[model samples]
Target: MSDAFFSEVTGRIPYAGLDSTDPLAFKVYQPDRLVLGKRMEDHLRVAVCLWHSFNWPGSDVFGVGTFDRPWLDARLDPLVAARAKLDAAFEFLAKLGVPYFCFHDRDVAPEGKTWADTQRTLETVIDQIAGRMEQTGVRLLWGTANLFSHPRYAAGAATNPDPEVVAVAAAQVRSMLDATKRLGGENYVLWGGREGYETLLNTDLAQEETQHARFLAMVAEHKHRIGFKGMLLIEPKPQEPTKHQYDYDVATVRGFLERHDLAGEFRLNLEANHATLAGHSFHHEVAAAIAAGLFGSIDANRGDYQNGWDTDQFPNSVDELALALYEIVRSGGFGSGGFNLDTKLRRQSLDRTDLFHAHIGAIDTLARSLLVAAALIEDGELERLRAERYVGWSGDLGRSILKGDAALELLSVRVLSGDIDPRPVSGRQEMLENVVNRAIWSVDRAELAAIGTPVGAAGRG
Candidate 1:
C-alpha cells in the first residue's frame, strides 16, 4: 500500500489538503507504508487541555494550599487579564493544528465574579469563542465542573453531606452541560476531583455514590429535554485530591454505570496519568473500558511514579504507548471523538511552544503506534495464536471459543478446562519493535526530509 491507500481513510488527500488555512482542525500525517501494513494516515482530532497553559503561573502551587488568596485577588494584573490570556491561549492552540480544546469553568472565570455572574459572563465569552471555533471547524469538548473551587465544597460536591452544597455542585454541572451544548461541544467530562473523604467516620460512601448517579441522571435528563446529542465522559482516578474516590478505577465505574442503567449515556475518558497514579498500565486501563464496551474518550497525559500524583506528562514510554494505539485499533478506530490532553506543566519556565512540541511529539508517536497495531491485527497472527493456544480446552465455553463459537456458551462450565498458556506466541516487545520501525519507514518523504534524513539513508543511496 502507498499514499493511495492513505487517501481511503483521510479522503483523497490529507486533512491538511482539505483547507490549508485552518491547519488546527486537520493536523494529520500520512503514515509510512512500512508501518501500517497498508498506506494510510489515520485522521484524528487532537485537543489540548486548556488548564495546562491558562494556569501556568500557578504551576508551583499545585497540590499545595488553597488558591483563595492569590486566585480571588481581583487587583492582580494577571488575574485581570483573563480574556486577553484566554485569547492568546486559543490562538496558541489554533496554530498548533489542534481544533478541539477542553477547559475547566473555574480556570476562565473572572476573579471575584459571583457564580451567577460567571455563568452570564461565560456565555458571552463562549459565544465569541464559538464563532472562532466554527470558522476554524474547532469545537470545545466541554469544561469540567471544578467542584473543588468553593470552600463550601471542602467536604465534597454533589456527594457533599450538606444538602445545599450538593445542590450547588449539581447546579454548576447543569450550567456547564448547557454551556457545552451552546458551544456545540460533543461531550462533557467529570473528573470528580473533590468527591472523596479521608475518614469513614465523617463520610457516607453509599449516599455519595447514589447522589453522584442521581446528578448524572439529571444531567442526562436535562440533555434529553434540550435535545443535546453529546456523551458524558467519566474519568476514573484511583486516588488524588481525595483518597479512594467513588469512581476509583475503570471496573468500578463500569459497574456503577451498569447498575444505574446509565451505560448508554456515559463512557470512560481513560487518562494515562490517572492510570499510572492507580498503579496500572494506561493500556490496561483502556483495555478494561473496551472490554466493558464503555470506552468513550481519552485524556492524553503520561504519569511518572517519581513525579508524585498526576503529573500529566506527555506520553513517551514505548510499551504503554503501543498499548494505547493497539487498544484503539482493536476497537476499530475512533470516528469523531477528540484526544483531550488532560495534562499540565509543573515547570513554570516551559514556554508555550514547548507545550505544543510535547503534544506534537506524543500525537505523532501514537499515530505511528496505530500503524503498527493495524498491521498486527490485519495479519491475523494475534487471533490465530490465541485460537491455537486454547485448543482442546475441556471447559465447554472455552471449547466453544476455541472452536470459533460464542463465549456465552461456557457459562455452565466452571473449572472444567485444560491448561492454556495465556501468553502470546510472540512477545509484545518484539511486536512493538517491528511496528515502530515499519511506521518510521512509512512516513511521507516530505515529512522524512523535514525531520532530517533517515538514519541509514546513505546506505539506501
Candidate 2:
C-alpha cells in the first residue's frame, strides 16, 4: 500500500447524530457536543493505544498472528517497517479522529545491539512521530516502557534480583520519560508488568520491595530534573506474566505508594480488564481510586465473563462503563489524564476494516455511557441516599469520636446505658439500581437499538 495506508476507509470518520445509520459514522460520540456545560471531547478525552492497535500481530498462545499487517512481517528492515507502521498508524488515527494516542517505547522503535544505538534509533522515530503529530493534530496521551516482553526481564524489571536488569529497566524508563516530555505527552505511565516473583523459593520479598521503591523514587526524581510537567502514573494488574504483581489493584497500589511515600508523586491508570482479573468490578476499582484521590487515567477495555484471565476485549458494556464514569464525573474529572482504549480485536475478526468497526462501536458506547453518568450525577439521588446513609457520622458523637475526644471507656459506658441501641435501616439497594437503570433507559437515543441490561456488580457510586 502507498502512504494512504487505510485506503479502505477513504476519509475521516464523521460524527453523525443518533439517527444516522452510516456504518462508519459515530452515532453518539460527537466530540463537540455539550454534555455537562463542557464539550463532550473535553469531558471524555478518548485516545487509541499504539501497542495493541498496531504493534501486536493478532497472535495468541495457541496460534500465530492472523491479521494482515505487512509492517509486522519479520523479513522487512525494522527501521523501514517502523516508519511504515507509523505512517499507517497516523493515517488511522487521523481518519478515526481521535485526539490522542499512547505507546510504549518499543512499540514504535526496535532496539539496537547497543544501548546507545537503541536510544539513537528511538530518537529518530520520536522526531518523526512528533512531525506527523503536528500535521495530524493528534496528541500523545501517555508513554511507557515495555519492560516485560524481552527475555532479559523474564525474572523481573525493577524487582529483579540481578542489578544489571534493574539498571536496564531504569534506563528504558528514563528514555521513555524524555520521549514523553519531548512529544508533549500528558502523562508517563509505569506498568510493572513483570515486577513480581513467581515463587518465594528464590525471592527476597522485602529486598525486592525495597528495590522497586528505590526505582520508583528515581523515576519521580528524574521527572522533576527533566522538567516533564505530566503526571507520573502507575498501572495496576493483579497477575499475568507473574504469579503476583506488586501493583495488584488500585487499593494495593495506593497502599504501596503511600508506604513508599510516592503517593503524591504518582496517580493510577486503572484498567477494566485488570480489575476483573483482580476479582473486582471495573466500577469498584474506579470508585476506590476516586475515593482515595488516586484516579488519574483509564485503560478502557473489558474482559470476557467466561475467561479467567486478561481478555482485553473492546468495551461494549455501557452499563458497567456508566458506573465508572459516574465516579469520574462526580470527582470533578481527570487532572491531566484521559480514556486510552487499551483494547484489541478478537483474533477471528481479520478484516482490514475491522479496526474501524471495533473503534466506532466502542466510541459510541463511551458516549452513551457518559450521557447516563451525567444524567445520574444531575439526578443527585445516589449521592443524596449515600449521604443519608452516613448521616450519623456527621452527628456530635461522630465528631467527638473522630476528634479523639470520646474515649473507648466512654463509648462503652454509653453502649451500656442502652441509649445507643440502634436498628438497621433499609439500604434500598434495588431502588438505587433502578435509579441507574432509569438514567440509562431514559437517554435520548433517537432510533438506535437498546443497550444490554447491566450484569449486576452492585453499586460502585
Candidate 3:
C-alpha cells in the first residue's frame, strides 16, 4: 500500500531518544529497548483502534461532523469510501510504526440495508484489509461487531426481548468471528453497548440475564466449532447509554463467567475509562481482574475526572499509568493480550499532524511508565513492604483459615479461651507514599535531563 493518506508524514517515525526536539519523533518509546528482559514493543504490544482513529468524525450529541476526511466525504460511494478508509488506515498504522491494529466490522465496512448485503460488504472489505496486513506486516489484534450503533439494537442485542433481534446479533457476531479468524486476529472482543435497559419497569431482568448467558455460551461454542485459537474477551463498563450494564466490572464479569460455565473460555478486557466510570481507579480494576486470573487485555485511555461521561481522552499522566503498569507487570504481563489505544482525538485537534502527536505522546507515556514500573520491581522495597504487611496471611492460622480447616466456632473458642488481645499496627501509608513518590520523581528528573529540560533552573525561578 502506498502512503497516500499521510504523504506529509514522509517516512516511518524514528526513535530519536529524548534530546531530539522534533515533534514527530518518539522520545521514549524505543520499540527495541529492553525492559524486564523483553523488548519494549514485545511487552507493550500497542494496537491502534480504527473506530476512533478513522471512523469517528469528531461529532458528538450537540454538533455535526467537524473534521475533514476524504474517505468520509458524502460525494464518495459507500464501498469506494470504505476501501479508501482502509487504505488510509493502513498508511497511518505503517507511518506510526505500530505493529498491530484493531477494528469493528462496521468500522471497516459500511453496513448495507439487507443482511446479505451487509455480510458481502464486510467480507469484501476484510479481504482488502487482509491484503494490506500481509504487505505491511501489521497484524490484527482483534475484531468486533458494532452492535450498539444501529437503531435495531437500541433495546439490546443478545439481551433483547425480541428473539429475532437477538438472532440477527448472533449472525453478526458469527460473521465477525469468522473474519477475525481469517485475518489471524489474536483476540475477539464483545462490548455490550446496549445490552442493558433504560428502565426496569418495562424490562424482564431474570429473562434478560438468562438470555445473555445463553448468548455467550452460543458464541463460545461457535468459537470452538470454528477452531479459532484467539482469546475471547468481554469488556466491562458500568453504564453509559443505559442505566446498568450486565458486565458492570471485573468482579461482576467474573461471577457471570462462572455462572455461565464460560470461565475457562472468556476473560475480562479492562478499560481505564470504564474503570473510572465504575467508581474505581484504573489500577484498582487491573488488580481486581488480575487477582481473579481474568486479566486478558487493556483498552488504554483515560477519562476526565471532572466529566461524568466517557471522554475517551488520550492518556497523558505518567504517574497514573506507572501505577497501573506496576500491577500489570506483577501479574506476569500480557500473554495473548495487548494495549489497544481506545481513545479519540479531541474535536479541536483537526489537523492531520494532531493524530501523530496524540499517538506519539500516548506511546511515550506508556513506555516511560513501563520503565518506572520495572525500576520499582527491581528495587524490591515496595513489594517487600507489601508482603510484610500481609505476613499474617502466611502464618499457620492464616493457612488453616484459608484451607477451611478452621471454622468460625473454633476461632471464637480460641479467641475466648486464649484471651488473645490483638494490637493495631500502623499501615505506614505515608511512608509507602513517599517511597513511590521518590521513585517517580527520580524517573521524572532523569527524563527531564535527557530531554534537555533544566530541572534545577525551573524550580529556582
Candidate 4:
C-alpha cells in the first residue's frame, strides 16, 4: 500500500500466458478464469502464510539467518519490528492479489516477559493488522499459537509432563483463538509441533495422551463459548522437533478425534510435506481425510524425497499436484479450508523480490495442475475405468456380502458347489499413467495456443 514493500517488483502480477518472459508474472493463475464452473480464485482459495513469508529469518539448524530482512534486524525494538513486518506482509499480500492470509500469535507480535505483556503486544499488533486488512480487503484464513518454538515447550506443549507448562500452553491457545475470532478468521489450526516424546523411557505414554485430549477439549469448549464461526483444524505432522508426533497422519488424527469425541468440532488441515514425511503421498492424505469426511484445509508445500525431514519446499511437480488437486476437487472443494502457501524462500534466494518469484511460480503450478485435473475429471475415462473395475460390487453376491447377508459358511458352500475360481485382471498401471500424461499435454497445448506460441518454440524448462 505505502510504496510497495518490494519496490523493485512493480505492478500487480498479471496472467501473462505461458510464453511470457516476465519472471514476476503468473503464467497460468488467472484469478477470474472459469475452471469447473468456478473461478480459479474461488476454486483454489490461496492464502499467504505470514510466518514463512514475514517471520522466518532463513535460519536453519546448520546456519544462522543469512537473509538481511530489515524488519528482522535485532537492533530494532521488538514491537516496532513487529509493526514493520506486518506492514511489509500486508504489502506483499496486496501486491500478490491473494484474497487471504494467515499468521501465528508470535508471528504478528513479540512475545513479552509476562502473559499479560504478551497478550497486550499481540492485541496491539493485531489492531494494526486489522486496519491494514480492512484497507486492502485481505481476509484472515486462520491464526494459530506458536506452541513449539519457545524453549519452554521443548519437552512438549499439550503433552508436557508438567501441568504448569500445559496450563501455560492452554492460556496461549485461548488468546490465539480469541485473536483468530476477532480477526474473522475462517479456521483455526492446531499443529502438534512438539506434542510427542523423544523416548519411551522419559515419557508416560498414556498420561501424555490424556493431557493432549484434555487440551483439545478445552479449546473446543472455548470455541463454542466464544461463538467463533470458524472450523477447528488439526494439522497432522508425523514428526520434526519431536521423535514421534501424536497426530502422525490423517488416519491417526481421525482416530484421535473419534477417541476423544471431538470429530464434530475438529477437522484436518493436511500438509503436503507432512504427508510425505509420514510415508504417504499428498493425494493419499487428502483422499483419506475426504473419505472420513474430515478434510478441511491444506498447508500447501512440498518436501524433498532425498531427505527424510520436512524441507517445506514450494511445490513444482505438476503430476503430483494434479493428482492431489483431483482428490480435493472430488471432495467438492474446501468448505472452510483454503490453500495456504506454507512455504519459504530458499536460502540462496536472498533478494526481497525473490518472494514474488516464489509465490508466482507456486500459484502458476497449482493453476496448471487444476486445469489438468479438471480435464481428467471432465473426460471421465479414469473415473469410468475405476468404476468398471469395481462393477462386480453391483451384482447380487457382492450386494449380499456388503449388506452382511452372506456368511462365511454360505459363501464357502456356494463356492464349492459352483466350483468357482476367480481370475486376476491386469491393473494397466502404465496405460493409466499415459492417460494422465495425455490430459496434461492437452492442457499444455491449449496454453500454448492462448499465448500464441508454437509448441516447438515454447520450452517447458
**TM-score top scorer:** 4
Deviation in angstroms for 241 in model 1?
0.2
lDDT for model 3 comes to 0.90
Error of 2 at 188 (Å): 0.3
| Candidate 3, 135-228: lDDT as tens digits | 8999988899999998989999999999999999999999999999999999999999798889989999889999999999999999999999
TM-score of each: 0.77, 0.95, 0.96, 0.97
Give the whole-model CA lDDT for all candidates, comma-separated: 0.66, 0.91, 0.90, 0.90
Q: Which portions of model 1 show Cα errors greater than 4 Å?
A: 1-43, 62-80, 111-113, 391-461
Between prediction 1 and prediction 2, which has the larger TM-score?
2
182-269 in candidate 2: lDDT tens per residue?
Answer: 9999999999989998998999999999999999999999999999999999999999979999999998998999999999999999
Sorted by lDDT, highest first, which candidate order results?
2, 4, 3, 1
Q: What residue runs in model 2 are displaced by over 4 Å at the alpha carbon?
A: 1-3, 445-461
Which residue pairs collide, candidate 4? none
Q: In candidate 4, what are the lDDT values of residues 367-459, reduced to their tens digit? A: 999999998999899899988899999999889999999999999998999855789998889998999999998997877876687878778
Over 4 Å off, model 3: 444-461
CA RMSD of each candidate after superposition = 8.3, 4.9, 2.3, 1.8
Alpha-carbon error at 155 in model 4, in Å?
A: 1.3
